[model samples]
Target: MRDITMYQSNGENELFVEQSVAQLPQLSGDTVTATIEIDAGQTYQEIDGFGASFTDSAAYLIHQVLDGEQRTELMSKLFDPQDGIGLSFLRNPMGASDYARTVYSYNDLPENGTDPELSGFSIAHDEADIIPLLQQALKLNPEIKLMASPWSAPGWMKTSGSMLTGQLKPEHYQVYADYFVRYIQAFAAHGLPTYAVTAQNEPLYEPQHYPGMLMLPEEQLVFIRDYLKPSFINHGLDTRILCYDHNWDRPDYPLTVLEEAAAEVDGVAWHWYGGAPAAQSEVLAAYPGKEVHFTEGSGGEWIPPFEQAFSNVMRTGIEILRNHSKSFVLWNMALDEQNGPTVPGFGKSTCRGVVTVNQQTRELTYTLDYYALAHFSKVIRPKALRLDSAASNELVRSVAFRNPDGSVAAVLFNDGEAEETVAVKLQGEEVLTFSMAPKSAVSLKVDSK
Candidate 1:
């Protein structure tokens, strides 16, 4: 019988994989064996942390979040490094999102007149989903970074006085800034301080079907420089400001805003909806100094099942690496079969979720999306540096990381049908052949020799 073995070493440990070369053992068809090893002097990449967010709705649907044992279990599964992926970053909605049961903001339907002095304001409305999720997340990973973005502003602040298709009234610019300050302060008071805030989600698209708003480039610049940034500074808040929480097709939007903000804001956040992955490079090229982030993208019902699984993983993992993004965040982590808690309700017939929660059984099964996320999150620890690597669009997509321990982690994906052999080159002279399954992904960690 022919056999094949794959070995990986990190200065501290060695990992080996052994299996039969043929599909099955010709003489003895009943058995198969595998071996593993750990060695010293070799190191892998240092990890930052890996994690998912607790959106407004996930907090409510997860029946026992506040309970101590349940909270511990949830936190452990999502944040504890030994037991879970140890997620270190989260994306929170400044107000309610499509995931919420209804549409509402902190200061909507105000009891008093809209005042810039911040008389009628509070995140009391978010106590339902936002607070519980943040508290639980922070408890699990105290170093977790929180990113807050609004799906829509308070209805009264919009042009139509509605959550959909309304732009912020120019007169309310300062008031809008105070709106952010109030939310940050309120959240901090609850022991869940946020790390950053995006001006708006999909600032270009106003979903009439769901609770969404539109903010123009000029308006965004005005808000960030004239309002948001200054407000944060005045309040002595360290929460950072991020611009352009939209797609790559509009790189100029954020670039212009950045030119206007002129270092007042921290970075640029982009989503994938309008076009190809290369769109990210456009932004990076224009503003090389600013950090680029892939804030939101996910598998939806429209794509076929096969493509969904394969593309989602490849898109998020390889695309993010290709674009030189700082991080990648997916939409709704968990959802029921029906995809409820959606604001105006999901437009598509099928719902997308990484982990489909079987309400009756309370069982969680990993979908293509989950596996795709795990391909990176499982191995590429947070804060892991994106080292240099090479791959084409057709053969295999990969990114290399230098771990804290000096070992390296490389995640590779082969979307083709036939098994493909890839050449993995590390350091200067070390090279190995890596064979990946058709339409599969493999993460190899090579410790420093």
Candidate 2:
């Protein structure tokens, strides 16, 4: 008997439950229904990992709000592979994103202040809350990889002299590049090395309320080709450079940057706000080896229903990976029960984090987004190759991965309005069968033995 495990999140709006299925009863005498065929022969990209960001607010909530025991419990649930979801990937704002307590940068200077030498640069701000929380997570899972991006450059670097709606001045390019080098060095010193970094976050547009910088493809080409890449090299840093941390709709943005600066950059980073997941493939067609990383996406108030959120997250998660994203990273790891502690001036909060914290009582509730992410991060290990799988049933949106240990993990979501059960045929050999509830998701893991 082969050992198989299923982690399922069902239509009842509940969390995922792990169950053991001892054996597969083979199809008897010419089965009428179709089966899902898994073939490891045809494989795809190596998975870097899956997870969400630990924004300023997320870190604050975890580090300051929770008691010591509660903190350890929560961190374990998020990072420990044996005890929790085992999220292997994560991102953090280099400075302030909209979720920060206040707008600030590592190299903040007074108004009309300019430090071209960047002598005042320090990561003391992150040292307060961000680093401690990250240290705990790494303790739980040493293999976790971190990626970082800046929402806006220091106020001194932009024309407006604040972390607001101003473009980065051309002359400060070299110093800004130096800022990135310092950030990588500082984090690594604390035992948290950054695996990748983007030039800017959502570079195409500037926000009126939050910190933002308008950097176009031309500016990025010059910045990476002339400044950023050189700074990393001169410092002897191996951290990868990713460009165009924007939406799927603007494939041209990253493609344009790659047209000239491809050598200076390792891959393209995407967001889910605008276009189609298939856009990744379009970019891949032009530049085959360059990677695609879904760096930032948020599930929020607009789609508030639990079942709806589950369907969207799993379907989109599978679709993007199928299109060849090495990693799937969402926006926030945790938030207050109010959906925020967001930028103070912003009136309405729309985003839903993977988990929610009740600052008033300090209680935590894991959201469906958490379970949706678990279906992938908990089953597929880092560097696992995506295996080819074909589904006969239309509602069966399945993506399979072959782990480095030779086990197989296939995630399936039944988009239809009713439950469906199908046999799983592995490499032309019948192995197992499982049932999926409607508008729900299931992650199936098959042992090599």
Candidate 3:
């Protein structure tokens, strides 16, 4: 027998609650039982990490609304491996996202302005709250990786001459690439080294209200192959380039870019808004070596009864990983009680965060999204490999992993209407029996004995 810890979320007070260590029983002879058998010999993609984005609004609420002591406490719960979920992968906006307090870019210009040389490119705006909060997160977990996405480029580089709705001007392609280089260097100066960068955020849809830019796959191919790739090489930047930072509905979008510049582009980034996770697999089928990342998905107010929503999102995370995604990332990390302190009058957001900071009571409320993310992020460590696990029942979907620390963990989310009990087998040996409530989750981890 070996000591193992079980963390469960039954949609009650037990939200990722760690139960006392229990001894796991070994399988006896001639016992034939249905079980979820973990095969460590068959390993898939290496997990980069799991986390949510730290947008401008999230940083504002975390840095401005919460005091020093409160911010430390909250960040510790978010980033500390021992004290919290230990989210290691985070995404941020290079300029501004829809969740920002205002619609602005690194280099803004007057009504009819053009900086062909991109002389005024500066990330001074992020210095105030965004950079500091990121620095604090680094202190909590040194393995943290930061990815940057641009909602839109500076107004001068776009056809509409505004961040709201525009297409990148063909003449300023190299200049825009220069913008990315400066962004990486600027953030790196603050000790926040960027791990990866996407060409644009949701390049297909041009939102009339928020900052969005329309970029076709063909255009993105040119931007990545001719400009972005060469620019990185010229500057000797090791940061990887990921294409298609949009929903799963368009797997062909990333395939188009990878078809032309497969070597130049590193991977594909996806969102859960549109189609199914199978789209990720479709891309991987064509280019088996490329990486798939679940970059952004949000649990909004539209989904009610917090517990059920958590179950759904937790299921979505598992599905994404099973589809072979290296990382699973959600939308916003924190939002104000009003759902947002959004770009006033424009891009009004109703999106919920993992945590919410009440502007009125000045208390941080940990939402169901936080707990849903905790189940996977808390147990899965960086560089962990997903082990091949067979699901014995249809109602229960699960993915098992063997972390780098020599600990084996399985995260199971029950989607059935009733309770489910399944035997857990580790490398052909029955280790434990788990009974999970419907619309609930459980994480069982066994340390090296």
| Most TM-score-accurate candidate | 2
Arranged by lDDT, best first: 2, 3, 1
Candidate 1 residue spans exceeding 4 A from truth: 1-52, 64-74, 110-115, 344-349, 392-394
Which residue pairs come into collision in candidate 2?
A: none
Q: In model 3, state the lDDT of residue 132.
A: 91
**Model 2 agreement with the true structure over 91-197: per-residue lDDT tens digits:** 98999999998988999988898999889999998999899888888898988999999999999999888898898899999999999999999999999999999
Error of 3 at 295 (Å): 0.5
- Number of residue pairs clashing in candidate 3, backbone atoms closer than 3 angstroms, sequence gap of 3 or more or interchain: 0
lDDT of 2: 0.88
Ranking by TM-score: 2, 3, 1
TM-score attained by model 2: 0.97
Give the runs in model 2 whose Cα sits over 4 Å from its true position.
23-34
Query: What's the lDDT for all of these models?
Result: 0.66, 0.88, 0.88
Put down candidate 1 lDDT per residue, 269-319, tens digits, no spaces: 877777656767776677766666777876666676664455555645577
Worst 10 residues of 1 by lDDT: 29-38
> What would the per-residue lDDT of candidate 3 be over residues 1-449, giving only the tens digit for each residue?
86687888887677988876454344343352336888989999989888898899999999999988989999999999999889999999988888888888998989888887778888888999999989999999999999999999888789988888999999999989999999999899999999999999998999888889999999999999999999999999999899999999998899999999898999999999999999999999999888888899998867777776787798889999999999999989899888897776664566999899998887998988888888998888889999999877877888988889889888988888887667788888877775677888988887867
